[model samples]
Target: MRHRLLALAAGTALLATTACGGQDSPSQEDGELTPLTAGVIPIVDVAPVHLGVEQGIFEAHGIDLTLESSSGGAAIVPGVVSGEFDLGFSNMVSLIIAREQGLPLTTLTNGVTSTGEQGADLGGVFVSGDSDIESAADLESARVAINTLSNIGDTTVRQSVRVAGGDPTGIEFVELPFPDMPAALETGQVDAVWAVEPFGTVIRQAGGREIASNFVDTDPDLSVAAYFTSEQRLAEDPELFASLTAALEESLAYAQDHPDAVREVMTSYTEIDQSVVDALILPRFPSEIDRDSVQTLADLMLEDGVIDAEADLDGLYR
Candidate 1:
């Protein structure tokens, strides 16, 4: 079964007009900075952004960063494409789909890479403690909930089901926000849910059963999320883009070495308990963008028909 998401053509066109400008020389003044509107989902994958803000990295780099919380990658992609946001966080799957549809966006930096561990990556598919679904195959005809359709969660779950020799098409996928997934599962509204970070850890702590993990079943090197912006913004203000990237890279490094610091920052933005943050396997943070890693996502989307055509990913990095 195919699911159609809201198209981004109109929003893309608007972003092109508002965010793009004729190339300008790099800014000379260092202290005075322009405000950048950034969109992000409040998942653990975006710990860098949160850490950067908490640690004043952006301020040190002369960037007045304004963060806007979005529903998911679906909302964030459009926000970046339409110039509503200068840069935003997005998953590889969503970015590939948008590029295929002709959105002139580019990845500014890498966010996180999944390490296929039992409690990491595809570790989000959870069942109630008393549920009979003990394995991936058992979820064949069961109802599953994902944060969003056609994004990483959906793709990973489908691939996991396929690997288990189950017909992915036989399952029903429902969309539920991350915050509500635990309740939905507890009440038997859904048999399993593909969540990430704190939510996944939360369910497990609450006695939910994890049937399978995406990292163990799907491709291991898959990138979970990254920082992306409109190409026009980069072309017009290379200095600003570089500053943002540098600050983010620094924050990414800090997040890896200081998971406790990241947890403190996360408390400011997410409702996830501090205990969950401590237990979660923090995602890998890369400073530079990796075209090959992103290309893998595009290839997978093309094979899955999530994207209408193959994307020209070579020049999609800033």
Candidate 2:
């Protein structure tokens, strides 16, 4: 069954912006503060970075952060490659695969994590309430929706299904943005969707339920999202890299200590209702990237043939 799985030579492009909400357009000119443009998704995992911007944490470090929202890891990776973004926030799985493909992305800080905390639904695989799919094994020969292919969404779903004795390769992935997932499930456009928060909360509100928890729990705690930049940036400007890292670490501490402030900042960026924010289980915000956790993801990709060769995990962090 493992051998039959579709090699994630899958599409890496991001989903388009949704109808209801999005980030402000990137501004080119700024007078006093240095401009830092980043590619990101408007999910709970990224709230800390934005929270930092709101509290002027980045500005204190001599940077004014602007955002470009991408719907998938594919979009963010390219944004970095094309010099459209100074840094990107995405999952370890995508970063690992991109590095193996020679993208030269380096991890800077930790983003999000899931260790099956009681009420925190960081992310999951879901089917509508009326659907017959009951387990990962039932997903064989079924259609699954993801915001991005060959990234976190693909890797975790495959790992969960394979553990449940299903043929993960037999499942077909249909690309759908996080916002579109609920409608697609209701109209029967797809069998199930793997979504990150607060969309997982959205799915449940729309009468959907998850079949698995900690789908991304490949290690003791899965590194679901991260902040990364090109190798060239690190080589060219060590001061900028160090400043960004230090500033973000402070932001993470502030976010962790003040949930209300994080929620307030999140509402400004994401389209999610305030009610969802009230109920949202904010992801674990760590100060530094865990090398071992990242190594686990790289090893998984090599084992699954998502990457052609072993990635130098140790070198991922500069």
- TM-scores, all candidates, are 0.90, 0.86
lDDT of 2 by residue, 1-318 (tens): 121112322232222222211222222144356567889888888888888988889988877788778876666876675556778888887777676666667888887767455334588888999999998888888899988766667777887788778878888988788999988988999999887788888888888988866444455477777888877665556666787788888988888888788778888888888888787666778777767776777776777677778787765776
Model 2 steric clash total: 2
Model 1 regions lying over 4 Å from their true place: 1-12, 15-27, 289-293
In angstroms, give how far residue 114 of model 2 lies from its true place: 1.8
Instruction: Enumerate residue pairs that collide in model 2.
Output: 5-169, 12-74
Model 2 lDDT, residue 115, Cα? 45
Residue-wise lDDT of candidate 1 within 43-135, one digit each (tens)? Answer: 888878887877888878877688899998878887877778888898877777776666777887788877657545624588999999887
RMSD of 1: 2.7
RMSD list, candidates in order? 2.7, 6.8
lDDT of 2 at 239: 69
Taken over the whole model, the C-alpha lDDT of each candidate is 0.76, 0.74
